[model samples]
Target: MGRTRAVALVGMDAHVVEVEAHLAASVPGFTLVGLPDASLAEARDRVRAAMTSSGLGWPQRRITVNLSPAGLPKAGPGFDLAIAVATLAGAGVCDPESVAAQVHLGELGLDGRLRPVRGVLPAVVAAVQAGRHRVVVPAGNVDEARLVPGAQVAGAVSLAQVAAAHGAQVEVPAVDPVDPPRSPEDTPGGCDLTDVVGQATGRWALEVTAAGGHHLALIGPPGSGKTMLASRLPGLLPDLDDAAAVEVTAVHSIAGTLDPGTGLMRRPPFEAPHHTASAASVVGGGAGIPRPGAISRAHRGVLFLDEAPEFAPAVLQTLRQPLESGELRLHRAAGTARYPARVQLVLAANPCPCGNAVGKALDCTCTALARRRYLSRLSGPLLDRVDLQLDVLPATRAERRAGARESSAVVAHRVALARDRARARFQGTGWSTNSEAPGAWLRAHPPAGSAVRDLERALDRGLLTMRGADRVLRVAWTLADLAGAGRPEQDHVAQALALRSRTAGPT
Candidate 1:
């Protein structure tokens, strides 16, 4: 009789799974059971090959492997190293007690070498949280695994090394802390507000949006620099705080978007999915278990929906909840899972399908009705949540030939200063930006006088819904802050309201 212990991961999360091996008198074979996915079920072959290559003989008698906590669905080949180690320990070939307090995670190759596995960071974090002080991971994942501060992590190059550590002394190599590559903002893309040439209004809108973390939309014709402006946004935003950077990196890791061997992502992410994306891909869904979609992956960052009106109506509608609540819920028959989606949205759309509706250099081919139908895809509910909307015009030929644009660093400095001020003003409130302030807080601390009355008047005229009124005020406050005003003024309110499209009109 032999018993061993391990864990199984579902998604990036983990749970303890004891892999118990029973050597019984029967036909000589090996069997694995307990709700294992295809990847986990195939671990037997890889484990066997690893053991054979490492000079350990396969247990010839009838064998049964049981993964405990049978209710949870286990997936991934990450269990290979654990399975191999447990099998060897169960067969009495190695001492289990030697690695008793450690959580082991790694895939095994046929030649006995340890291979990198996905979600190593999350697994290590889970192990630390579970009070497991030690974690044995593959060498390639050593840096990623060490992101978990409290966990004592070890790196093994091969299953043979891990096995050797169980009996005779074997030294696992220490992974040096290699700083992850800095974000594009650190290097500073040469684009700048000044380079935008004209469209001063568009640039101001972007500045305010950055200061307040507000969602924005840019409607313009081609060559108007909408995409160019959108790309420069990341540079205008402040560097992510430590907690935010970790979470951003975690999402990228779960999505397998993290660069190989990268540590933590220090800057906020920028995710721009194509317009043709399915609702499942944009908002996250799968037949088995839902995964983080573009919205979730953009947590603590920006989700730029370029060519916004070109997206499917269903997909565009899916963003309403996440835009409002900073989280998205995927409801499946089996369960409901939520992912963080506190992202600043930047949506760019052509004012008309023809890309030249408002009398640009090109003649308009699209009828007014056709243009209205196209823009109407963004439902009123969706547009109401967007805090700022700006109209962009094509840059003049003179501005284009000026051959100079402001560098990202120049705009980034102002953005950082504004963010610091907001943080300082809202310290201890859990609301760092004007856009994040709750309606209750805004009302209680009504921005010094007639602004509240003006808002009430607008609400009375049915110009704003309850949610819309709140978002409008939030935008007003953001506008005032950008001008260095002490409080939101009537002018700021008017500016915010002007930016909002009427519910009855085409968006």
Candidate 2:
């Protein structure tokens, strides 16, 4: 008998799976039991070729390898190394006890080399949390695996090296370590706020969005600085705390977007998918099990949808669930996977299909009906979930030439201060921003009677849904924080109502 440990990733969550092997004096065949996806099931040939290349002869007897917790669906080639090590132990080529205590994670190449696999960071975290701190990963993943505190990590370059480390008398070959891929911010042009020349309303909305972790929508024609404002929103946000850093890093690891060499991701992430992206790619879907989508990758960060109207309606509608709950629940045929999706969604769109419908509509080409249908692509329910909706008007030449409008650094300072106020206000609530606070909690701690009057009237007039009313209150609280007020006053509520009711194009 031989046994070792590996991690099976289900969305953002990871589980430690025990890999056990049994040898019998019967037909010389290899049998892999337990539920493994197609990629994992193909590990048989990979392991065989790797062992043969390493001079580790295959067992002549019937070899049976079972991934315990047989019901847990395992996928990917990450389990190949664990399977190979366990098989060698059962074949008596390596001491079983030597490998059983360590968690093995890597893909076995046909040439006996160990290849780096995604999700090593989360796997190591799970291994350490499970009280099994010893982890053996590929050289390329060593930096990421070591990020987990109290984890004993070893980087092996080849199968022979791992086998030799586990008491097998084998000569390990020297090979170059695999390098991790870089994850550039995808920030085209630049990521500075000053690049946005004008649109005072747009900049103010961005500040409020960042300060409270709220969703925003910017409507206008082309070259209106919508994308520029949206991209700079992440800059105004503060760095991720320790807990959030680990969580955000884990999501990127699972999504294969994190660069392990950079260590933990401290800055907030930014994900902007194209409009033509399918619902599965945007909302998190796959064949057997679903993986993290753009929203999940943007966890603890921002998800910008440029050209929002062009996106599939199905894809846009799917965001309503995560927006309401801050969690992505992807149900597939095999199992259901959950990922954190507490993101600030930023949307930018043209007022008309012709890209010329602003101001007096002098240059506009689309008909009234066409313009109405254009903006209507963004559903009312979806818009209601958004906290800030502002139109980006064409910047005047004077505004463009204005000397040094507030830079990202200046605005980020104010945003940080405002966020600090909100954090102190909700100290023990486990929520960091105004947007995250429960509506019931907000109602429980109402600001003032007069302040509530206008909001109540809006609700009574049917202008605001029950959900929209709560969101308005949240925005009012954020406004109060920005103004250094003790609580939202009538003026703050009025401003919030105005910000919420503003729209572009027809409606």
Candidate 3:
């Protein structure tokens, strides 16, 4: 008997899987057990061909490989290396003790090469968390595995190299290092805040959104630069910190969207899923284990939905949970996979179906009911969760032709500074951003005294729900942070009220 280890990704989390192999004298056959998904079950053929191609002999007796905790559902080919190594150990081809000490992650190609598997970062993270110090991965995934600190990672190209590294008397092969993926910042012709000709209010709202990690909605006529503002939001945001970058990278890794060359995703990610995306695609679900969707992909970043109202009502409504909780949970028969979805959602929609309801230049062709029905697609519940809902109009000729405005860099500087202030205030509170701060906590520590009079007035008039009032308080705190105020003043609360009022009615 030989035992080794691998990892099973349940969402972005990794669970260490024990792989045990046994050889018995019987009809030559290979049997893999322990509830593997289709992809993992096929590892038998892959491991056999890879071992043979690497000049390793397969045990001619009956072989049984079991992924124990036998009831746990395992998917993906990540277990291939572990299964192969354990089988080799069981056959006396390598030292079982050496195999047992290291965590193996990679898919085996029929030609003896190791192919990069998804979720390497999280798997390596799991290894470290589980107190396993060594992890073997494909050469292409070396950078990602190394991102996990304190782990001794060895990157190899083929099964033969992995075998030799595990104490087998086999020759090692040399492979060139793989290049990292290009950063979004390096991509030319990117959108910038300067490209947005006018709408000072819209730009300010974007800044506030970035500063507080708040969700926003932009309602306007077509060609009003709604998409432009949403697209450039990432530019105004700072790079992810070490911990956040690793978490974001781990999510991207599980989704198979992590660029090997990009290493850790320092820049805040930006995901703009078309309105046609399904609920599963937005919140994450599939045949086997649920995968991370657009929201999770946009974790710690922006998730922009262009033509927001055009999305299916179900899809639009599905965001409410994650918006409030900052985590998306997909429940399946297998289990629940929770992915961090602390995404700053930016939703854009036209003022009307024809998108000509706004601006005096364009005659209002849409009927009153037509306009109402269109905007109503964005349910009140969904709208309430959005912190900054602004009505964007076409830029005036004067504003468009005005001298160059402040660039994303300038706004980002202010945003970073404001974030620093917020971080300082939230030092021991466990809340990193105003949006993440609990309403109860904020209320208990009320921002000074009479500053919330305007909020009370709105609540009295039914203009704000408890949730809305909580959100207004959060926005007010953000405003104060941005202006470097000691606390939210009456003016800050008033400004926050006005911003929320913008999305209160149908145009």
Candidate 4:
């Protein structure tokens, strides 16, 4: 008998799996046990072809391989290398003790070359956490694997090289390593706040959105520069911290969107899915196991949906859970997987289908009923969660010609200061931004009774839900932080309610 270790990734979490090979004194046959998916079950043929091609003749005896923790579902082709090593160990071609001491992670090609697989970083992290510090990965993944601190990682060009290192007296072949399939390189749009010509109200709202990590919605006619304004929000934001960088990096690793060359994702991610995207594509679901969706990919970043009303109602509704709580729990028959869903949702939409229902100059094309039906696609519950809802207006000639506008660098400095104040206030707490503060805590220690009188009146008139009121209070705190106020004053509450109201009238 011979044994070794491997890893199984479900969502962002990685679980350690034990690979064992047993040779029986019976007719030559190969049997694999443990609950492995169809993709994993095919490892037998790949391993056999790779070993024979490497000149490690297969044993003509009954061979059975089992992945322990039989109930835990395992998937993916990353187990190819581990199975081949364990079988070699059982056949006395390598030292079993040497093979058992390290965790193996890679896909073996038919020619015995080691091919890089996704989620190497997380797999190495899980191995290190499970007390196995030594790991062997494909040469293409060496850079990413070395990111894990305290891990003794080795890169192998082929399965023969790995076996040779494990005390097998074999002539390692000169097969070239297979370069990993890197995610398509992303190019920044180079969007800047200066590109937005005018609309002071829209500019201020974007700053507030970045300062507090709040969701926003912009409703206006076409040519109003809604999309231009939305794209610049990320530029006003800050980079991810150490913990957030690792968390975001792990999610991308599992999704196969990570560029292994770039060490860790320091810049906040920005995901803009088309209106035709399906719920599974946007929210993250696949055949056997649920993968990280656009929402998770946008974790600790922004998810901008242009033409929000064009999306399927089902897809838009899925954002409620992630918006309310910064997490997503996807359940499948195999197991339940959780991913971070902390994203700032930016929705931009035209006023009507024809895109002409603006101020009355008799240029409107859509009827009242059609306009209502079109706007109704964005449900009330979803709109209520959006903190800043405003109707963006076209810039006037005077506004356009007005002197220099504030650049992203200028606005980002203010955002940094506001975030620093919030960070200090929320020091030692799990919360970091004003939006993440709990409702009970905000009420327990709130502004003076007179300050929130307007908010109470709006609530009494049924203009806001309990959850909406809480969000309003959160925004009020954010505004206070931006203005360098010690607490929310009456003026701050009034402006907060105004920003929350959709009637932010045509400027």
Error of 2 at 491 (Å): 2.8
Tens digits of per-residue lDDT for model 2, 319-354: 989988889998876678888998999989898898
Q: Model 2: how large is the Cα RMSD against the reference?
A: 2.5
Q: What are the TM-scores, per candidate, against the unseen true structure?
A: 0.87, 0.95, 0.93, 0.95
Task: Give the better candidate number (1 or 4) by lDDT.
Answer: 4
Q: At residue 425, what lDDT does model 1 achieve?
A: 77
Summed backbone clashes in each candidate are 3, 0, 3, 0
What TM-score number comes out for model 4?
0.95
Model 1 TM-score, all chains together: 0.87
lDDT of 4 by residue, 148-195 (tens): 888999999999999999988779978677887877646245888887
Would you give me the overall lDDT of model 1?
0.74
**Which runs of model 3 end up more than 4 angstroms from their true locations?**
167-190, 359-362, 445-451, 503-507
On residues 344-424, what C-alpha lDDT tens digit does candidate 3 reach at each position? 989899988899887462677888899889988886647768888888888888886899788899999999999999999
- Quote the positional error of residue 405 for candidate 4 in Å: 2.9
Q: Which window of 10 residues has the lowest lDDT sum in candidate 4?
A: 498-507
Task: Show the colliding residue pairs in model 1.
Answer: 192-406, 195-405, 195-406
